[model samples]
Target: MFRSSRGLYSHIPCPVLPRCRLPHCLFNHGQQHQTKQPRQAVPQRQISNSASTAGSSVYAGKGRVSSSLLIGQSEINEHVSLAFKGSAKRDAPATESTVPSATPTKRARQQVSVPLESKRSADAAANFTAAEDEAKDSAVVYILPVKPHPPALHSQRLQLATALAKALRDNKLSTTPNNAASTKELEIASRTTSATYANTMKQHIISLGKRGKSVEKINAKKTNEIPSERILEYIPQLVHKEWQLEENKYLTALPSQNEIEEARAAVASGYETCDRCTRHFKVGAEGQSECVHHWGKPYRVKGSDKKFSCCGEMEGMTAGCRTSPRHVFRITHYPRLAVMIPFRQATATGNNFPSAVALDCEMGYTTLGSELIRLTILEFPSNNVLYDSLVKPIGEVIDLNTQYSGVTSVEDPGIPTFDATMNTVLAKYIGAQTILIGHGLENDLAVMRLYHKKVIDTSILFPLDNPGLTSRGYKRSLKSLAFSMLQRDIQGTSRSSTVTRSTTEGVISNEGASCASTLPPSVVAPDALKLEGHDSIEDAKAAADLVALRVKFMLALEDQKRAGATTELKIAT
Candidate 1:
């Protein structure tokens, strides 16, 4: 975008030539034409012994095309001489010469010498030649002789002054006159008075002479005068000013102001100011605005009266620039964050690996059974916290659940609403082809209000291979699976007996599981006790981790089915 204007500046001061603006010459008339053709071979003749003549001995031979020789006049003559040898006859020479004595270099003429008949006639011819030579010698050199320059006297000087004045008025002078100054001022700037200007005029005359203009000779009286150097200085500035004037006229000849403004508006809508200006543009936004130096050149003013110079720098501004958005405040991870992310559709096609992490969210109700709060996204494979946004419930916490899904009401800290939190966290995931992994992925997908068909539910993958496991697997919570395979335990929620008085008063689980869906008391986790409340991020992570734990061993046993599951672990490690 940073373009150089040196070439443009160089051309700005050039003299305007009318013919230079005309269309360029396209065809080269002097170029020659050429053609190519395939070569053809001429057949050779043969002599037969059976067709012998009466007096000559018979000889026969077959002739073929000779590749060694070129066909030309000499070869044709040789062939003719050989073919008519027997019928050839000699003839006596006639008085008239058959061949000329000398051949002309050009085809138009040849020389034939004839002997002179008598000395008298030759002498008479010689006398006529001598008289012609003498006459040519006596004739004056009638050359288109070059004449010397006329004297630089007053008469010649007056003629020059008149011609110069006429040429200047007609705008026919080679050099442009200064339009910025009056005639008297221009003459002063030229540093020559009428009395002493003849010396300055001489050099101009000499230059004009070289260009084929008629010039008078220099006189002895004018020989010692020196040409003024100030005239030389005035010449360049006048030419420059004249060129600027022409540019001003041309620019003024452009379209209407309304048209120019419309064009400017069109360009402005598509482009923006540089970063410095953008900071001033969006001063109170959530994310920091990123600014970059502008690549624009200095602005220029067109006319002498325009006043603006070509030295003022211009900067461009842009909006919504970020290195990374997610971890904007996470100073430790800031270096790895990518703010202006380009979203890509999840694709299972091509030779790409089929592994992906999954996340789930959980919400719980207040004591009054009125409002629901808390939302979290969990990263599978490692059960890492991707995002956990606490949401203030619409109602107050009354009865606390101490069993099953592990959640309570004390966690809210005046955080945003569930909708706001979800909008922020969910935006990080959910793309065209992302593969979500979980136990009952459909239910989790339903809770998150996100749908992706490329998910792999361990419940389905393992069940298809083990019928017994399938029938008994409903008992397998993510915690049970995690304990059995990965040897990691995740606690569920524990509710007091008073709070659990009526199973009808079902507290809100963000994923919304019914009392019927709860596991038996015998297998319920003792450590599933709620501190202040249950976290959605924790639950989502637990579920995703449970699937990932079982998936590890499941992948090992079935190589082709889940081989890609290990790709994520390798990258994370």
Candidate 2:
């Protein structure tokens, strides 16, 4: 076997350094090298332009390293960068420039060429190692000297750098990479991967958040059901501003002589404004063929472009996708509205009035326009029905709108007229000071043409929780409030007829409609619930209960404040 150059020069002392740290060094140091006086080892980590020129491939500034070697058994001193590189080179075959006069020696012939990439990589590794050691001793880059990693981890770091270099060369680079991109990939990867844990992970920043509990859940947990009567006390305090209505745009104006005559002519001609399409149509000739409308309200796509919920088509992009069985209408003009049931100035607040009342009205399509079909009123806190009736409309019936109104023409003849029922039935229970509570109370008040001060409209009472939903023109619905706060379900396909009374059987006469004196809300079985659309009585009670819940949450907050104050006082005293 041919002797290698490293084996031949194994006994030679390194020329520049007084003590050779390398094991099995390769350079010839016989008579030719012995002529030079030995120099001291570069003062621990002291880097200079000339310090590493003779024995090291790397160069550094006036940098220093006070820390000991981190390379474990394969230790590199102050010149770790150069020491590591020199050691690696000695282990392999030695390469050199050709001496013109000398013949090629056996040792020289044994030399296998090293790739440019390999030489650059070795030099870079040496430089990085030196810089890091210098950074620790001088506090130039890093102030603190980090504890050396376990010796076992060095090989993994090397392996990771190798992998990263391969990936950089193979993929991540552009058509023409940066000038320094060739050998620096390993340095880049090494520097990045050696990072200590971030403060978020190391400093223990995360903690548990408050658990969510709904109003109903909190009440059940606390084991204290707030009294319903407390609703009256907090009603004024809990009422938020910007929700109270002062005037009436929604109320139909009382028709004058001209409006009455014009309305009479319009009725005779059978032409009325189509509430859905906004175009006038002949009621006598009303049919499904000509009418088209979106049954659902308008909404937006991704909160920008407006569209109808029924068809998901952009508004005005096409005609209504849903064809009605028959065209229905509603009257907004007071003169036209008054012709059906003359608009009445609601009796002003007076001494004899329930502190609060929940009012709901149901309507059906009529020849004059939309007319009141049913009205329900429940007193607050107690939730007792102040009034409940199917008020007979004077206009020729067009469509009962029974899908929602829960009224039919079969009993329309026997029901009380608008005049008799409002004057006698509703007048008996309601007075000036009554605070009417209902979701979307404006629509009900407008349809009934009953306006009074001191109102608690739940639609405006509880703003939608999400500002995004509010910006998108969404109103908080009563169903969500009842389910969330009270844990009660109302306005379904079927419900109890007491609160769930049958729509068919509840069509009482004018005399019976006026006799609302705490008549126990008839509680029929769920099977007997005949209400097809929404129940006015159920909705009224829901609105009332929701207000009661607000009072309860207030009571809870008050208790919390009182408890906290007491605890602090005790601690101080």
Candidate 3:
């Protein structure tokens, strides 16, 4: 065994001997040689590189040994003796051989000779060991430093922190004694303030009630139950038979004339000329002048040139007249008579029929009880008057309900009969597909003897708080709804005198001759006269306005939904 500088041992195979085969003797000699001469270790760096070089040199010497074996015994013995001599020299010291020689030729000549097979095995072993050393030296490994992380908090500490935060939040929300006191004071003040306002409004309404005589008349007429026999006496006499026939002919004519043109023709006829002004006041003309004393007031002198005795003057005041003279009628009055004018029946076609129309009807006491006296229809949004007429009931008139109806007399000329309005105006313009909008429309339709299915009633749309209440309380009033939802006032009057006069006449006719002396005096506050009779045009338009507002809000909501849906779709994409 020979120790290398890398602390590794290299073992030599059996040494060659003569044909006598004395292995024990050879072993003893190898031991004696190793004891006599110790080998020095080789350096680790030189050991790996020199290992293969030394093995090749030994293989070269072994190739010559086989040729020597083919020689005679004398030659073989001579070769064995030479080998022994070389072994002696080679075994002298490993240190001397490990030192690199200056001359490569001298190093080759100094190599030890041994058996061919043994040298070959030793050379192969050395080459393998050298390869292993080279592989180990060429390998590489890397190590990286680790970083330390913060330690986790204990469960108890975390719970403590959470509780502390919660306690602090609670402390902040808890009201102080001063704050509590202040909140209570504010609530009390608000209640007191609200109560004051409510009381004020109630007193104001009561005061208005005393001043407006028309309001009392309206209420009385609505509540009073008149006998059917007595109602017939109020009906006007059919004195103008010829005129009625001619009016009917114009109404029943085919290819009906335009309503506006027909109205012009009626004014030109001069049949309904005002007695005082002698100016023709068409039945439906707004703000027309007429004698206020047409019913023969005691204050007016009874003569061909009838004059006002109340003012103690014959000439009439143009601006304000309280006598027999032409006077511009109220807006309410104009629409009332305007509805009486008849137009030839023309069937509503495509665009001729309005998309939506709001309707309202006024009923008067007649032999048939309550009867439809006036009907007003207005187109939605545009608010155009589609059809407006005073419809004479099938039965005789009893009370004109002039307080609310604004109809002064049944004898007013140029007014179309109920049959004519129903056949010519209502039937022609209103169809099954038309959307009829109104407030409390059922009553109006029932009075007119009309059965329209597509109706939007504001009363139904905006129901009262307790809808399950009695019939009278089940629906909200149109005036209340208009004021609340639309922030508008309708069916209100600033001048109570005109309303009182109209109402007094209606009451007098309704009650017969004896009740005139008992009638209430004409007195009303300008601002307080807002809660009175129904105006057809005003009520119809109010209903339409409500529907329009609802539709506008609905469209806005639909647009918002559509916009949100579009945004979501885009986000999804």
The model with the greatest TM-score is 2
lDDT per residue (tens digit) for residues 269-308 in model 2: 6666788777666776734346787766787667578988
For candidate 3, list the clashing residue pairs, or say none: 5-42, 211-523, 211-524, 284-338, 339-388, 339-389
Local accuracy of candidate 1 as per-residue lDDT tens digits, 1-573: 223444444334324332222122222212111222111210000111111221121111212112211111232223323332322212111233332122212221111101111121233223333443222111011100001111233343444544443343233232221110112122321355456556565555455444332111223233223222322222222112222323212111223456545544554432323222232322123454544322222343554222212223321233222232211111011111111111123323332322345555444323212233434444434344444443554434432332223444445344565465545544554444345555555444433334245555544433322223433443345546556644644443332121222244323222322222332221112222354333444445555554443333223233422445687668889
| Range of the 10 consecutive residues with the lowest summed lDDT in candidate 2 | 136-145
Query: Is 1 or 3 the stronger prediction by TM-score?
Result: 3
What are the lDDT scores of the predictions, listed in order? 0.32, 0.52, 0.42
C-alpha RMSD values across all candidates:
43.7, 23.6, 45.6
| lDDT for residue 347 in candidate 3, whole number 0-100 | 39
Off by over 4 Å in 2: 1-225, 238-272, 282-289, 294-326, 333-341, 348-351, 410-412, 468-473, 496-531
Error of 3 at 419 (Å): 0.6
TM-score of each: 0.26, 0.51, 0.34
Task: Give lDDT for model 1.
Answer: 0.32
TM-score of predicted model 3?
Answer: 0.34
**lDDT for residue 79 in candidate 1, whole number 0-100:** 33
Candidate 1: list runs displaced more than 4 Å. Answer: 1-355, 366-372, 380-383, 393-406, 410-413, 462-475, 492-529, 532-542, 546-573
